[model samples]
Target chain A: MTLPKTRWRRRSAARPDEILDAALTAFIEAGFDAARMDDIAARAGISKAGVYLYFGSKEALLRALIDREIAPIATLLAGFAETGGADPEGTLHLMATVAIERLSDPRFFAVPRLIIAISGRFPDIADYYRTEIVERAIAALSSLIAKGVAQGVFRPVDPVLAVRAVVGPVLFAALWRHVLRGDTDVPPARVIEGQIDLLLNGLKP
Target chain B: MTLPKTRWRRRSAARPDEILDAALTAFIEAGFDAARMDDIAARAGISKAGVYLYFGSKEALLRALIDREIAPIATLLAGFAETGGADPEGTLHLMATVAIERLSDPRFFAVPRLIIAISGRFPDIADYYRTEIVERAIAALSSLIAKGVAQGVFRPVDPVLAVRAVVGPVLFAALWRHVLRGDTDVPPARVIEGQIDLLLNGLKP
Candidate 1:
């Protein structure tokens, strides 16, 4: 006997990954405040109830999105950390290359824009970002700097401050290019190389 | 007939400076989103109508707040620019000192917070900030760096990138400490000096 087609049946059988992918696209297009559950469901070709079943609410979905996006970056850096920090310049170049490559992905820019857009209304989300994503990134960079200092490869520097200086410029450059200037074609690698060179060589007579 | 004592009369007579001072405090305390015109008027001991009489809307008040707060800073830097990059180290120390001093001011922190908060909600406000404030500051710093290099007082560097590296760390450090970390006691001067040192002397061994 053939079964009758229903929205619930379609939703129940839908993949979680497909739902998340659709939700991300919806969130990017309309922002968190404007994005509706129905839109996400529509994008996923599932029922609205199915989205709620998978991700409790819109806020939960956003949290899940952030986690899903940041996890891979953290993992990649974790792997880089295992190699130690004998070469400061090479390590920085590698990190910058990887960072630029990741940032080229649409999700990277979209996630931050989403956060900044909703940060005022949802302070907790911003707080989570600071503690989870920013602090973790800083800690990773700090450990690498400390390792480099111990090896006497890089100059003895305050690891925390040094990490801030190195990472801050790259992040702001991307922000300026993508968010402010709306110039995605500007090569992130060139900007990163210029910044790395500036950091390595002081503007001194 | 003798003049009748009225709250409206008293509020109407209040000075523009006093109203702005109160608005700044209110904006800082509750932020742009939560702050009310009535509260600002009450803080200034004026009526809400009196507050509106001077500034047409909440956004206009914010724009005025930014203008009033940053004008003095622009004036101070104007004096620095007039010196024509004679002493690079001295000029840097002076600029760093001014940044540290401004960070110490509650108004400096509050104004930016309000702007950031409002900018998230209003795209035009953010556009005004990018064009008027951020770009202008970058231009001034870039010109100073170019002059310094041409005067043979500093190393030949990409002035634009160098200025960004030199300024970004200091600005973010203040934002991190005050806004994010909420640590008022953190000495900004020491941090600024350290950043200046880092910029003058590269991190290479």
Candidate 2:
């Protein structure tokens, strides 16, 4: 097959990131199944063979994308969980703030959207995402909440349920902003701060 | 075109509901753009013409399904908001319970899932859902929260963010149960109650 002219461009350290970026755009625009490697290569300014050299298959690219984009967040959450035991509330606020900032960006939010959209057709992708990104994040958050409970700063609530409370609004905000394309008059940071305040302080006068 | 053998069944008052049920299944199984009217009719035990007679197009069928399945819930929420001024906390509890109960069901949750999946490809569908279902629900819930604040039962939180707090966990639960297919160790009602308690009481000792 004839290679695109841009394929002659020299490879650099940023090749993987460029390819993944292109893959994300292709997947979002054309869907995972319909997105072709040729298009992804062209978008990345590489040859199809170069794309394949980096990612053996489309699924591998997705997995790498998840790792590249979401895994670091999960790792950061874990780091916070470990370091935040002495001050869970403050750590939780920091965590939520970071999460809201990241998710508010449509490019960062696209992975979960892609997973949610295609999960029914590809259970394995859903399973991978749940295990790799979602479950790890929940586990880290749960540990932080559990630390708060242990310290007697917070009430004894089930960590699982508490994690949901912590994550739900953040997730919803992302969905509202990205998926539904709702207009957000309030800045994302402000919205998240409000949510965190409500969680920590309750609605009682 | 030859009609499917099952098309001869007599039309009943339930025909519309049947067609909608079939349409939902078809749409979920095959992405909205890929789902065929012929398959929907066959699934509903009606002819293609019969399907078209009731619904002019696939988009129409989707709209009708949303009305049939989700509109009443919005109406119910509005009713609660109207009557809930006297007891905002109690009414909020009742509302969350109702939402959790309905969303826990996969069949009931499918519409939102479908919308989230296809909104990128079909902006009009997304807009229709936002205006018809999500916005209405948020408005009703926000009004209820405002009543709570007016009565001093709730702190003066911004009704918009407050609505997100109220909705986030419940929506997350549905996504957890249906999309990720997470195993629910705690029952949904209990989970919702825990979240509501966390919201109203805060996490403090």
Best by TM-score: 2
Alpha-carbon TM-score of each model against the true structure = 0.80, 0.90
Q: TM-score (0 to 1) for chain A, all models?
A: 0.86, 0.89
**Residue-wise lDDT of candidate 2 within B74-134, one digit each (tens)?**
8999899899889998888889989999998777787888777767767898898899889
Tell me the fnat of candidate 1.
0.40
DockQ of predicted model 1 = 0.34
Scored against the true structure, residue B44 in model 1 reaches a CA lDDT of 80
- Give the poorly placed runs of model 2, Cα more than 4 Å off: A1-16, A33-38, A46-57, B1-16, B46-56
Q: How far off is residue B42 in model 2, in Å? A: 2.7
Q: Which residue pairs collide in model 2, if any?
A: none
Model 2 TM-score, all chains together:
0.90
Let me know the TM-score candidate 1 reaches against the reference structure.
0.80
Q: Could you give candidate 1's per-residue lDDT for residues A99-199 as a string of tens digits?
A: 76676666776675566545545678778876877677777777887887888877898877787688667666755654455345557787778888877
